[model samples]
Target: MLTKFSITRSCALRKFTFLFLLLSGQILKAQSPAADGKSSFTAKLINIEAATTEVFRYNTTLHNGDAKSKVVELKADLPIGWMISFKADGSQVTSVAMDAGKTQDISIEINASATADPSKYKIPVKAVSGSDTLALNLEAVVKGSYGLTLTTPTGRLSEELTAGSHLDIQLVVKNTGTLPLKDIDLSSQLPSNWEASFEPSKISSLEPGKSQELKARLKVPDKTIAGDYAATFTANNPNGNAPAVFRIIVKTSLLSGWIGILVILLSVGLVYYLIRKYGRR
Candidate 1:
């Protein structure tokens, strides 16, 4: 009878221990956080290609996995002469507030140097909330930018000339871009019966931030009326073109002015004589 009682007590103790362990495990699991609850930073499009003159944009998301809200700061490592900004909900911001298990959309805007060479650049970005941090890598492929400016050395686009005479005006062509310009042809549009010619009418090549001086010869017909005329000068290439309008004031010659005075005097004398003779008759 004693042995049977001992055996029964041992079985009951084992069952109680097993039940206790099972209940403990269940309680621990209920209190523990979900495995999927973790902070993350991701970008929808991490790479882009554009001209150096354009602004680059990247769309991204920041997620908070903690059970509490937090403020996440945004930052980036950029090249020299570059600019960067972060935007959330169409407003510029340096940081964002995110709720637990929630996500926030972000827009990154970057501006590369106007003189940046054509190449691929890597930009590392980060989002930090207290002890936890997330990172994302981005790329920008810059392309060549072409630009030109046509003007005069003094920035004056006007000149005076005598009728039936030719005038030489100095002009400047500048490469106002990040890349070299080649095969640039110079041309002009003049008034009817007027003529224009350019010295060194074609430029083989022009480096960035460089300027070349040339001369434009303009000729006006002998009978062209004395007035202000419009002329357009153009510098064109396969990549780009620039046009400048110049005001050309045409004036009669000094000799022509003297002849007009003489004619007026003669007409007055003739009129006076005719009036005197006719009145007497």
Candidate 2:
């Protein structure tokens, strides 16, 4: 009942089966590497960055890594640990377009946080722009544990800085937080009806334990109203836009004051005569 031929054939078959499995594994090993072994995941959202004025905006776009027609849903995914800030002032609607049935690129938004640098306060965007629908949770947060404290610029302005006068308004941006401040953006609002220009247009950067110099040119009109005026300002790093308001007080020259007086007199006389005649008593 035991034939040597049959037994030999079975053994041969078993050997071949073992060889096949071994070779197949080698082929798979040569083909691709496991993602977890060396690849890194996409960046995740931690905080919502924002601009002080709603008129300004921050945005970015992403593409679906898949090559075929795939359904993609976009959402914001916030990191577990961070101080998040949410304000309704930054709600500006937007739209994104993609190639039909092809690449998947979705736009992501970084919102403004309550405490962020005024100049570089930008939120990094991360979302699943892939074949699967994604629900992302995003929010705003300050930069460091001991975040930068933005001081609102405060000071007294000069009265009627003469026309073509060098306009140097001193402002103090202090480090109110445990951490330091750097790369600050200092901007001043011109008088309501006044035209002025800054030497640098903008102060590029500043660090904690330091104060920066900024100056502008105030060109008064020949008929400029010489009196007290004020302008709002901001000493900002991207963290947040703190308000710096200053008083600009000025007085017209004697010749200019005389011209103003003459106009006032003529106007007062005209008004008085008109009122006297119109006395419908």
Candidate 3:
């Protein structure tokens, strides 16, 4: 039979061997990267604050922590009708090749359609290299797109005009947009040597769904031919601009019109008198 001291010694030896192997395995795992020259990677995403229907920019920074250079591909899943692109050094790119432990700054341009409504949108960003993938989330705040519309109070797009006289026109300027409009400048397109002015050259402020009246005085040239002509009135604001057209019908002056009527009557009376005097002769 085995003695008690021998038995204890055997058990101690077995425990020592097990502990030594465990420590050896830990050391190997810690040094495996340096020994095998394997590469590691890291990716990061940045957030976007806000954007408009107009072209806006966001930025992202990526770092490569591996010992080897890699071509990292980037992509984004955005809302419908939305677009995203990446740029580095002012040139567009779909992916970036970076050296180990190096960082790159990329320009992320995001744009929405003009018809896009005001809301918050979440964008999913991805970076991939081989089997490694990094997922990130971003938010885009879309502000309202403002617009201005200039028209007649009755919504008539045409108006009457005369030469050598001042014609008064009334217009309705409305803020037909999602945001308030301010400092709207009024202007007009007219024939040469003609003059046009508005009562309020610039509006102070116009809220959405609000309308204001503007009186325009147009001075037609004396020599303007009597025919159809087109004139445009525009209201321009920082948000957008609206244009209105008017059809000018240059009518004959009162004096000329009366004279024409008198001539026609005289000619008819003369004809009647000649017929009566020579009918029997």
Candidate 4:
């Protein structure tokens, strides 16, 4: 039979050995790095129909024992028909295009008319084979608010008007580019002694291929001069102020009194004298 002290000692030794083994196993596990620790998205633009493409990608990663591993995911954002053109000198801006997700990188071709063909184009090699591999088509559909605009309206003024009269100024604001212009401020530097008033001094918006009518009333002072009046109408740009010019002339009624009658009579008498003398000669 084992003594009580001997039995106690044997149980203590077993417990110590088990604890040491468990600790050693944990240390070894800690040293190993997880194989699947990160997940991210990578995108590349491939030209298919347009100039440039904006691409978005997503990646998912999971780390666990064979049966318990889970996947983390990320999404890709790829726009269609987006393109960028570089300047030859590398200083000046050539061209840039954005797109929605329906398109990849687009091939550009100069048509007989010099317009880019969106339907028949291909992507460049560098864009497709790149590591990102995400294609985005950012063909700008529309940007900013629009109604009707005129790029030619800057620095434009109507002809001079008589004093206290309204001038029908036909200002054309065109959508020179393929964008919309909104809520533009219209202001003017009226000619000296002239008051320029416009209806709807502030526009609501301007879309492509549309126009607005600005009824302007011009008032010239009685003391105004007959020379050209320089009036500058300005539309302040987000970048700078665009300007237009108008001329105004102050005019007066002609005199039809004794002076006018005398002038007519002198002309008639001179003509009669010339006819008589020539006929006799």
Best by lDDT: 1
For the record, the alpha-carbon RMSD of candidate 2 to the native fold, in angstroms, is: 15.4
Misplaced by over 4 Å in model 2 are: 1-158, 162-166, 180-182, 258-281
Better candidate number, 2 or 4, judged by TM-score: 4
Give the distance in Å from residue 214's predicted Cα in candidate 1 to where it truly belongs: 1.3
The TM-score measured for candidate 2 stands at 0.35
State the TM-score for model 1: 0.81
* Worst-scoring 10-residue span by lDDT in model 3: 34-43
Q: Candidate 4 — worst ten consecutive residues by lDDT sum?
A: 96-105
TM-score of each: 0.81, 0.35, 0.53, 0.39
Native-vs-model 4 lDDT? Answer: 0.45
**Candidate 4: tens digits of C-alpha lDDT, residues 146-265:** 223333345444475554456656565543333455667777787556676767787666664566656556666755545666777666545234566665565542442466688999
| Candidate closer to the true structure by TM-score (higher is better), 2 or 3 | 3
How do the residues 27-108 of candidate 3 rate in per-residue lDDT, one tens digit apiece? 9876543322333322243444443546656666776767777898988898788888889889899998977666677777
Best of the candidates, TM-score: 1
Q: Could you tell which candidate, 2 or 4, scores higher by lDDT?
A: 2
Q: Rate the local accuracy (lDDT) of all candidates.
A: 0.92, 0.47, 0.79, 0.45
lDDT of 2 by residue, 21-88 (tens): 99999998667332322111132443444332222222333343333333333333343322222222
Q: What is the Å distance of residue 215 in model 2 from its true position? A: 2.4
Candidate 4 residues lying further than 4 Å off, grouped into runs, are 1-158, 237-241, 255-281
